[model samples]
Target: MGQGARSSWGRLLADLGSTLLEVVHGRIPADRPVGGVVIHDPVDEPVYPENSLVLAVGVHTPDALAPLLTGAGRNGGIAVIVRSPVDLTDDVRRAADDAGVAILGLARGATWTQLAALLRSMLAEDDIGHTQAESLDGIPAGDLFAVANAISALLDAPVTIEDRSSRVLAFSGRQDEADASRIETIIGRQVPDRYAQVLVERGVFRDLYQSDRPVVVDPIEMDEVVTQQRVAIAVRAGDEVLGSIWAAMDGPVTPERAATLREAETLVALHLLRVRAGADAERRLRAELVSRAVEGGPEARDALSRLGLAGRRVSVIAAAALPDEDGDASEQADQERMAARELLLDALTMHLSAVQPGAAVAFVADTAYGIIPVADAAAEDRSAALSEDFVRRISGRIPAVVAIGHAADDVAGIAASRAEARRVLRVLTTRAGTRRVARMADVETESLLLELRDLRASRGETASGFLARLVDYDRRTGSELVNTLAAWLDNFGDVPAAAAATFLHPNTFRYRLRRVAEVGEIDLTDGDTRFAAMLQLRIRRD
Candidate 1:
């Protein structure tokens, strides 16, 4: 019986040790008790709730404490047992020296506390494991590959990816070998059918684009000749639905079959999106760097020098990419967008390079742009006008909004000219208000000064008022005097061009010049009178 009891106690201790460690390590629920503890020797008996615990210890020597301690452990309770016997001191007794397992000591009481701590630790480990597993579930590489392979293996089905413009990027897994070939030819080509139109008429790509989940189209309901079967997954990452993967079977779709294919489709779509996203991020970075460089002059040139493209004059153009008026773009929107931007840049380069030798054009960020240094400043103007005309031509060929900026003589003018071009673009494209073409000459130092002078003169009783009065009299009466004065002064007080401006023949205008001396005012060729007539034409003419 003694041996059996010892074996039982040993087994219990082992279990308790393991369970205690797990609980204290937090492997178990936090609120769970690791083990029971009892502290005795208090005046009042402490009550613990059913799920909670307590420690009891009796205050006495070995002779007084044995029974209670022994009974506590045996009954699955713990006690702080004090014993005095043999050579064992109070410290030794507290550690339950020379006592059997039944007589647990203060050390044993601490053991339960350690066990609880161990359980808490374990719980933390479990949580970490759970999170890792969930993350794996969300985007597991092996799972994704398996799913994609499964999709490609479909016997009578063909898979395709599309951008918003319904341009196909990838096509695989076709029931018909000929269909595969046709789709291959179609890859990198825009789906001729508008996705929106398709959605309205047949509800194929549009429905797929709108769906947040998988959609299965019944082949029987669709046109048997053209669209035998269709199963698609909308490729969504965050709020953006990049496009979709559509698998078309040769026949009608069953629910079970659709469900099976749906998982694989979704996986393939997500993988495609992930791949595209990475590429897009890299491209965006490159484009942004180029954009800032183009817009930043010295800094841009520094960057260009680093890129081995310094000292080159560049022309910048802006192109807006948007949806075509007519199509349903459910599947291939992203591919179309990427292609459109690429195509625009290529087209711009081709067009510009054709005209100007060594002209380099590229996409500067989101828009298509071109840069070139020409033979002369005037030639640059002509080339820019030509480029604008060329853009207008191509814009007609492809659906796009194109805006061309003025040509600059050197890289230093790039940033400023780009600004001017953008402003002109807002004027031309947005039509937000009445716009005057922005010319560098219009904003030049001399022109600015003249404008400031005009404004200052406007505020005062200066040349403007005198000119207005003379012109007003001329309008009221059939006036030869005003014309004569204007012509005589324009001729440096000679009766010439000023008379022509007043709509009289030169000789007749000359007669008016002599008439000014006879009519109400100063001498016909007086310097003040001439200056006044000139100011009248400038400040008050319609």
Candidate 2:
């Protein structure tokens, strides 16, 4: 039972005790029935006459010196005296003081009012203590129950809870079978990525805090109605935000609905704080395990298992927001980052039925890091078009630069693939800007071309310094050796053809060729060396 329930019982006991005292003291009329059950106020079902005479007991020498007697007095709804006795030590006095229970050491025994005050104080302490315990679990069940019950009572509508991550945790009222099934489907499932991202990046907390108004979102405004319920309120705890509670009802919010929602908001805030604490602890633990997996090599497999992504092929994708991009740069405003995380997870499950899916995707306002699974070429080759189509559709909605990394065949190379993909992403950001796709293999050419251009740009740089100098020279003169090399390679290393095409002489062409080998510090005579250099120059040209 909740704290509210317990307090109610205590109040009932206090009432009973008061009535007994009145009867014992001959304060009530003999005609008043004492043994019959009476009910009043249908809303509360108070179960007694409002005008019943209250009773008093234990008047002298710290009445009810026994702890049990003190508790009994509370249970019986009567007031008792507090006088010095063997059991009423200094510690007891202090404890009573802490609980705000006034001790009446009445020389003429206790009065009715004294007993009533003691009962009231003890009852309040019990309720507050219950609240403190709820804070420990990250779920203020008592608070939530109060709010939910209040809302139900006020609006006659059901309310439900969703956590920081936007997953439904529980319901406030009895739901029909279909609604229950829908609730079951959503419970424990993550909140939509877009909404979560919006909340995180957009100062949604501040908005929620600054206003007493209810957040009203329509189905058309959201673009998709995934749930039957259409309303939600974010729960907050001081400066911290915990989660939200959504309600599904058949009609627009009436006065009763508004009142209930307001009360529910309070409970939602407290409960959200409690649950978030627990979730935060769990998230920290999960993050630690993921970090260990990234560092531990084979032992990392254990960590992968902990994340539920062990022994699977992995795809690491790197993406970033461009300065040219419009809208929010903060995490809260970047729905794309969050949406990308969700779409990837959902797509994997929808597309690959056989493989167990595991992913770790991060949304960092301006950039995103993702590690997911892609089955073998045979499996994904056929689906490439479909995946590409999916990406195109999404990209059309949210402009971004996305580079997919080398897909590691298994968990063993997930780390290496992620690193390579990140490097590719960096180059893409520098070279391709935003709204482009880059492959890791393609970046090598860009890097090399950049070096060659640097060498040629340097005045009188030695043949040996050609490639090394290319990098430095380009920094100085901003010339284009990589493009020149690309032209040469495209002509199959034909000097005359390359020179003619580049609008340079045969002598200059030969000089530049020799310099290319010198500056690159590698022999072009070797097929592997030539291929590497040629590949680098060509890719950069493109």
Candidate 3:
């Protein structure tokens, strides 16, 4: 077996110890690779080479060090070592530390030529070993684990396979070599935001998406977050980016290693396609089950049982996007609406799963529905509160209204719950300025009023004669009598309170009331008349 063409900065430090070089300020990033060595000349225009360890032979001033370090950082150089007896300033040290580049000083009597020759020898030895390895001719496409294992062995580094969203699908079982960010990525199934920010700022993702070749990333050190060097190869099928294969390199990746990573990318893409097909089939099955349950079919209970939700009390929730005020309705707006719906569904799925496993959520007829299990008496209350919070959080992003149904004891009652939720949602859509999230129980009074109104309309019955006369008299004469009567009825026929509520004196209110009774030909003292008038007023209000 031959070694790969890669060597760490720590390894170079060890090989050049006899050349009287000493690390004075910043520590060596042991995981970062030192590709080669270059001697800096102050007379010439400075050029920093990528992955090269630079030597500032006789330059020591901060002005000279500032531009050199800054240029080296922009070009992706690893480190800059200077000869001793030159005064190094605090500004230069801080700059190197911020850029995550190491600063080392050589002891007296050591020359730049001697150190450069040693680095060349070590790199040459690495190349010789790499040339003896097997050719990158064929890669097995069927077994994903085998491919990951082979890449890890070939590069002698930990590897991770992730989807385009940065969700880890598979990783080499090497936790010992993993950092905090790596472990967090594996556990959370996504890259952490801090580390992701660094990669984004460096254009790492842009390079990966736009090219087929592997992109090498230098070591990153934020205030509290740090990561080792990495090489990323995009896994693409045709023009679509399927995923990526990331190798955590402890040294510079040679040409041979980069080629092997590209080969592994092809296998990853094939495996991802297969995985996506299976997921589609599974989603179809789940959608069918949800549809049947909503319809209350004979197989609904059986489907719920097969889905591991037997005998569980459940509630249905429906969310629909509210109409836009500006009424754009263009193709771009439609596309944006679709994207918002998808994001809302994704957020709801994640939230529900975190609170209760096996909760089923589906999108139907431009509305997303969730069937949440209520395991106990308190479960429904808890779920309702959580759903309210969920709606509040997404309200700014997705202008939607959410309705929740009453809890049912079994899957057979799911259809009734869904109908109730739809009814609540319908009422919300017609009314403006209502709360975004509502439950069926919260709208019971309005629901009953709706039913009464519908019954009256179907029967073709007009309003009671007492209400009709009162409304007509007020509209024709421009009188406040009808409003006064409604207010008095609402206050349980309290004349003084009604007068105060309408901002009139007590005697003036009594005079108006007498006119109201005289004009409408109704008795105010009779209990039966008062009740009848109140009912009519309520119905007319609805």
Candidate 4:
């Protein structure tokens, strides 16, 4: 790994220091490379890579935090963040200094989850296993924070680079010098809705996006978030608007600075393109690794290792959107289906990763498969519950089916688990959204019947014996005898229930049942007769 392998501690502060965090104790080891982010769990200690940033949630006092800091320092941790208004007492400061660990204060309103996500994003861009690409203009490719800071220096003002939706992608330091609203935006990583509304109504976005020149805007009169006027320009790649740059300036147009802003826009465009390309590359590589591990061969172990799932017990989940067979057969419809599949895959990836740590979700052809690591015996049951929850969460948006397989205790067993999941999925997909989440144990009967149907068809077989007779009679007479028998069997010989199900009178249903027995030569009394009839009906095509 080179010096650029990861963002150093100094860079973390320079990027996040203004709004999200503050240094409360110890020197900021600016050059220390933070390897990863880890949540502190007392019962199950986390494995901390070198220079880990430990998020010590709920440890607030001097007595409680002192020992944890020592432990973290011994494990090569670079810093520990505690919820703010950090105690910062003399004793706590002494402990942090003694442990050689810096203490950071998380903003009072910011969530630990959001902080972790931000840190992980930074770390992933400089992951240890992959070599860092050479810098493109003295700044690392796709390093938006560095670009934002450089642009700020060139313009001599606090700046922010934002997506078209007004979500802040990156910001330079000295945000406090801008406005209360600017500070709020920096804290939330988004322009407040009131400010966005102000901009929208003023035709600010339309004018800025339409012209290459910087558009100057009057000061907004919203709450604390809007006291300063802003100069904004759209960042574009050809005709596509990638995002925009915003600077809080004291006065009006300087031609040279606006020209610099235009040049900076081109650089930001390149960085955005690189960021998108990197994400796609990472996704493709992950899919390949997941495919290899699920196929289970000599290199399966290596794939599992790369996925961080080696030596772990796991269950495979297979999920897909129910096909809209009745939808219009147009190019637009096809694109909609493809988009739906991608949405399902993204939801599965996010929800599963939340449910189980280190889970891997990826697409293999038309199906999206998830490998969820488990520590308990009821792996499939737990997976089913999570899958059901996910399906319910996205129910109205997309109708989907999810199948969970038995626990695979090792990498060698994962392939079998995936096969079982896919087998169950095949049965569920045929059922037309009847059951959205099912495990092999829950749908084994349906799966077995499907296998039987496949085998019988391949051998050129059809309905046999009494079932054949019932089917033939129904076909010739255009009667409901076959359906009558099915309803009777399904209702466990409850005549009135079967009658209601078929929307017929009880006497009519009873007469049909009698006809079914007599015309098909089937005795409705024998257990073997009922079982054989049901099995044949389940497997037969006609």
Candidate 5:
């Protein structure tokens, strides 16, 4: 992350500690810039970007926390967050110190998903390679957190900027000064239903939105959800209500503070527009450049340069979900498939962007492709490793295959790399196995055989010679002669193994093998004959 965008470690703790978070162990790196936030996916080996904050969701007990701290430290992580009520054993503390990662506990009510979103919103105001951020009245542009804090400072109260739906968008520090309801709202990133119901019943939202001036609400009469008085004003731009800003205060709102709240509302609206417009425009432009570059035509060179991959050797990673064998042709099913494709594409982009910063990922047609700038031809192995890790991470959730193409040295070779990557994807999708990631080199023979099968099918070919005889015999008598022969060949002529595979006694399998030879009128002893039989069996669709 750019300096214009990232938050320092000590600052994160100071800002969030009041409500949603608290450090459990290790020393804080006050100056370290947190580049990104990644959820600690326990099932898949993690990929940690430099200066990352890893959210260890569902990680309870000190034993689980200890190893995560160690791994995060080794991978350049800045900190880890587990759910609160942490045991924080001695071993966990030692591991955190050794790995140089701070373990923070999320407050009891906070959701990991919401925390991850809050952190991303903080860092993502700037682009991946953004150099410097423009400022709006001294605050960094589109930085809602800073805006919230500023409002908090001027009002001398903790603030929360919430959308019309009552979801918290950004919150200010000193939240500890607020009541339990405010704390609950911040942790969940949404107002509790009962609290929101009270507001609705009392017409608080109606009064707040209708009036331009700040509205003051009396303390709640219920349980200790709200004890502090609430001051809120709807955020707007020329009659458009963008959101609202709320401040928890002990005293009544004075004239000067009321004026300040109005001023803050206008600034907040402008910033909201800026954030939305900038993000949409940037995403469209970047997606276009990636799409064109990987497509590879007259515009490829310029597109690659724009993508920051100019003059660099690159490898392509192609990924696609295996077709669902049970798919129906309904429109809803098609829509579902398309949604799954986009989800996989987004996951690919996130994974690649974190592990390899300069890499570009985009969905081109049905395939999600990644173009990673590499050191050289040898870099394909590294690329393959990254792809494998990603596949393993998304394995059960998505039945997809990831394939690495050989390194492309220049603009001319980019298409070749993409094509080869598609070929590898083809091999993986057609075959059955737990292996979901591979490179062209690892499956060259399988790929060639697949191509041969395609050619043979296109030519209207069918099994011939002795193999055809056994097929006809099986079809006529309903015998297992051809399968028996295949099992024997598959086991390298080991009668016992072949019998085990066929669920038959060795003598019974031997009898079938003799039948195969006699029925096919073949020479079982010849190596050439066996090779031909195996090839035909593998390559023939029939």
Candidate 6:
């Protein structure tokens, strides 16, 4: 017997004959498989094995069946067979129907041990036949489509293969038998939100992630859009759930069909692992190319060409997480931040690609950098909008700052774009209450000032001597002369407006401006001197 074999409740009851057991409340799940048999004991705790047909050996009262069915369903049992003679109630029947658990009656003189042994032998023989048939002419290995088609053929149902995130990876092309939810999922390449919510409320996904067996979902209690039963088998690699195979069933799942689905899961897992490996390799190559372009290596232009961005106009963007206000520096917090950054970068890459094909993104140090090709002048605006949208989506989840550089003509201009983006990011991180999305063009004046400041610092130059003396005079006398000077310059030398802005009378502001000239020993009437002093004051504000 193959290890993957299963037996249906109807077949097991028929094999036992009317002398052993009979259908009572709920009909046998003709398609639902029973992998094993368990004898229910009142004194001991119930053990609900996966896909098992449970035999309630002693108690068969109507009230007992309600909790029994509910508990069995929760524990992943397929059906319950009662050995007692008590009559079944409507409430019990309804509960069993709602939970999708089948109920059966064991006739007098049928021992639990005897029924269990008989079931094992029958299932073994069933498995042997199935193993032989599969070995002869079953679905070929390593073919995801063939696997889906085979499962659909064996169960006479529509089938879909999806990643763990409920993204549809493939479908059996049997749209004729598909429900609205299934069709929607296939067309959108993702499970619809309403349908996904239903499954989550029912704890279907929890079971899928926690168990190794196929989970049977009853459509009767589900949304009307889901018109058929579903059996979700997790495609696993060791302990990891790679994806799932969803089969839409018109009726209960039979053991033969269940075994086929299990086999299909194995095949799908292998295919997913291969697909994931290939995708990872390609992602690595693209990330490396972006990294090279950002760093301005000699190979950058060639790398950009390989990524289909050689002659295209492109913009570079830098994204970094803003520091937490509370300043958590624990190891756990660090790990969490790293994971969040990676997730954000991945999302950015996906969104950028959707907006601009062949967009390349990479995470370097604490920042994520992307080289995005712009189709035309309009594409630059589109890229900026997309970047803002991405930032908004990730806000609160991960507070991040995104800086966009100006677009340039070709791959050769990528380095300059990246430098501009990095410069904008630097200023953004230092300032409080900066907008989440910063553009180089918007901060051109600030960028130039920052560059000039850096140059002065490298040359070991100090602040303008005249501005320094004005600052010293304010410090000594506790006066507002330096602030008045900054305000006057900021207002383009408008004495009244600057005084109004400073909340001082015009005559008082004029008096401070005169004091500023005497304390600084400079001519305030010169435009070039005012310009240089204003720049100095701006640079030292922080």
- Winning candidate number (lDDT): 4
| Ranking of predictions according to lDDT | 4, 5, 6, 3, 2, 1
lDDT of 6 by residue, 460-539 (tens): 98765887798777788899888999999989989999999999999999999999899898798898888888888887
Q: Please, what are the lDDT tens digits per residue for candidate 4 over residues 92-184?
A: 778788888999888764556546655665566535366646464678878899999999999999999999999999999988889888998
Q: Give the range where candidate 5 is weakest over 10 consecutive residues by summed lDDT.
A: 1-10
Error of 1 at 160 (Å): 0.8
Evaluated at residue 412, the lDDT of candidate 1 is 63
Q: Note the Cα lDDT for every prediction shown.
A: 0.48, 0.49, 0.73, 0.83, 0.82, 0.75
What is the lDDT, from 0 to 100, of the residue 450 in candidate 3? 70
Q: Which stretches in model 3 have alpha-carbon errors above 4 Å?
A: 1-147, 150-156, 163-169, 175-202, 218-229, 250-259, 273-287, 313-352, 356-358, 366-368, 372-412, 424-443, 457-464, 519-529
Kindly provide the TM-score of model 6 when superposed on the true structure, using C-alpha atoms.
0.59
Model 6 deviation from native, Cα RMSD in Å: 18.1
Off by over 4 Å in 1: 1-157, 173-188, 191-228, 237-242, 250-298, 303-308, 313-370, 375-385, 391-536, 539-542
Per-residue error (Å), model 3, residue 388? 6.0
Candidate 4: global Cα-lDDT?
0.83
- List TM-scores for all candidates, in order: 0.43, 0.41, 0.58, 0.71, 0.59, 0.59
The true-versus-predicted C-alpha distance at residue 524 of model 3, in Å, is 4.1
Q: TM-score of the candidate numbered 4?
A: 0.71
lDDT of 2 by residue, 1-542 (tens): 22232233333333323321221111223232222111112243233222221221332333333342334224331222333232456654544444322232322222333333333333333222113343312433335555554555555556656665556666665544224333453554555566556555756545654555555443322444443434556654333345666665556766666666765666565454334334433444454555555444766677677666777776666555433335558876666556755554345334333332455544433345455556786643433343344456556554445566676755557677656656666666666443366666657656456556666556554334335466665557676565566677778888899999989998988887776666556676787776766654543344
lDDT tens digits by residue: candidate 1, 410-475: 566777766655544443433322222234343343333345456867788454344545556677
lDDT of 5 at 154: 95
Model 5: how far residue 185 lies from native, Å: 8.1
| Candidate 2 weakest lDDT stretch, 10 residues | 19-28
